[model samples]
Target: MRRMLKQSALVRDNNFKGGLKEYAKEMGKIGKFATQLKIAGYVSIATDIVGSSIKVYEAAPEDKARTTVVETAKVGAGIGFGIYASYLIVGLATGGTGLIVIGIVAAGAAIAAKGTSEIAGYGAGYIYDKVESINE
Candidate 1:
């Protein structure tokens, strides 16, 4: 029984050392790939924003163009804040350095921010319309 225990211990030590080295190498590769993914994510966001801006410009009437611009600005600000805040919170919670993980969190936060921005914009527009009508 004592000899069996010693053999098992040696086996465990050998396997653990080899496993840790391989795991470290794989983690380094994942980190590099995640960084590339993060860059692609940001590029995609920029293109989406630009494409949406162009569509808004084409669809909005000459008079309401300014309103559209303002609403777009508000949405942009909301998304920016949402992403930043989410990154901070998630980073603190998980202590993660993986770009892909943070990117996923940011994406979800951005979607939530979009819904919030739309609601706020609608309310602001309604209030503006009511005030203008009252003034006239």
Candidate 2:
């Protein structure tokens, strides 16, 4: 059955609400790593953004998925920044030795979250592609 096959993708975890929650958290984790690497001058922010943009447009809706991606990215970014803002602020306030590092970490994490969302969208596009391809 088509519905049964679709359910297969979920494996041990299958629920729309559960999926979204996992997606957002995964994005956040990816973002955190991205920030740390970017701060070390080991990565390009532009590259990540470009990749995400492409994904957004791939399976895009009538209004363009980029819009949705951006909106969702913003929400994700906001959550990331919120989680770290206080630490960054206090570090700066105390004249910490590495506020720059803190900032980079925060920024990277925010962007990473966006990129993760992009990746998720890309997966969705993959499924669409498969359906469009068909064996017949």
Candidate 3:
């Protein structure tokens, strides 16, 4: 009985070590991919900014176009900041995990951040519109 217990303990230790080694190797791969993912994210943001600017220019009248452009820029900045802040917070919260795990958590955080920001912006805009109408 004693010999059997010793052998089982040894097996469990070996399995744990093997699993940890595999997890480390996967994390290394995720690290390499993270660089590429970051580059893609930057490109995506630039594309969104340019596209939004073009739409604002085309849609707004001549007198309002500049103001629309500025407002669009503000919105973009807010979204960018929100995403970065959320990412930082989530990264800190998941400090002990691999990049893949961090990415997953950060993505969820970013999505939630974006959604909440949009809702807040819409609510503020609605309130401002109502107040302006009441003043008029």
Candidate 4:
């Protein structure tokens, strides 16, 4: 009977140890799954942020220039007129109508170039502000 009892206790101890090992293994798998799920969640959020930024950029006025002829013409005319007028005054003081015309044309071209650059800068700033606001 003593030998039988000792054998029973040994069997119980072995079973308990085996169960603990299995539990630990299962917990490890759960931990790995949890970690993967967290990584996936982070990736999803990052994708969403990028998608939203793209949407905002696409919706902006600068991006719309490709499709909006009237707005483009208006901006072109305004910049040309404003910059040409400034340069024309200087050209008139130094030369005649010929120089004034040349100055106007040159100023219009320069303004067109600068206007494009400013629009790009403004678009970038708008996107930055939008993203910052979204994060907040």
Candidate 5:
């Protein structure tokens, strides 16, 4: 057991709780709403590709401090999407046409949102990584 452990260079405690805890903080004052997530390699790549155009609006000094805009936007979107999905369900009563249209729109919106959000999220992560690297 000791030989195997030594050969593998295994540490007793393998708690990879992330090294850069406050990556978002490194890019401070980025706007009214700011947030970050501990994403994986694939996400970072995706973010890099799509975040090329999306500009991150930073907060001005004169503006009063408030809750993070990123978090607020995500939460609001989540809630909004939920409601929107529910609309499709309720609209089923209107008629087959209404249901069909709503269904099609909802499906398209969901797919687009999924891709857009991923790219946006990756953009945020990419920014954080770059900021942190520069700071270091």
Candidate 6:
């Protein structure tokens, strides 16, 4: 009986150790995935910032009509890029399940970029017209 009890205890010990090893492996995988997600988030945000800056820059008034048209196209491209980046970020962050969240965030970013660009463009144009008028 004593020998049998010892053998059972040993088996239990081994099983426990195996379970712990498996759990550790799973945790390590989770950690790696989380780290990747974090890195992706940072990259997305950086890209968005750059896109927004480009839009803002394009908003500034240009003296030539051709330049203005080119700037408008650039601003549109910037907004489009920002929307795509935001969608990618949200999809990655939520594992592609949160459709509402992705749509809202993407839309919000695009709208914000458009509104900001328009405001800045109008302001710059107003200032330029005022300056030109004053000079004349």
The collision pairs in model 6 are none
Worst 10 residues of 1 by lDDT: 9-18
For candidate 1, write residues 71-116 as lDDT tens digits. Answer: 6655666667666765564553344244466556666766676667
- lDDT string for model 4 (37-90, tens) is 446435644554464456556676854533233233434444455455545544
Candidate lDDT (C-alpha), each: 0.58, 0.50, 0.56, 0.48, 0.40, 0.54
What's the TM-score of every candidate structure? 0.50, 0.29, 0.53, 0.32, 0.32, 0.36
For model 5, the stretches where C-alpha displacement exceeds 4 angstroms are 1-97
Which residue ranges in model 6 land beyond 4 Å of their true spot? 1-97
Predictions: Cα RMSD each? 8.7, 20.6, 7.9, 31.6, 23.3, 13.0
Candidate 2, residues 13-48: lDDT per residue as tens digits? 432234545544644554565465445432444555
Cα error of candidate 1 at position 51, Å: 3.4
Weakest 10 consecutive residues of candidate 4 by summed lDDT: 91-100
The best candidate in terms of lDDT: 1
Whole-model lDDT, model 3? 0.56
Worst 10 residues of 6 by lDDT: 8-17
| 135 Cα displacement, candidate 2 (Å) | 10
Q: Candidate 1, after superposition: displacement of residue 122 in Å?
A: 2.6
> Which sections of candidate 1 miss by over 4 Å?
1-30, 60-63, 89-107
In candidate 2, position 34 carries an lDDT of 42
> Candidate 6 residues 1-136, lDDT tens each?
5456344433235423444444345445545655764565567556755765565566636546433543455455555655566556555434422334544555566567656656655665666677678988
> Against the hidden true structure, what lDDT does model 6 obtain?
0.54
Model 4, which residues run further than 4 Å from truth? 1-18, 60-136
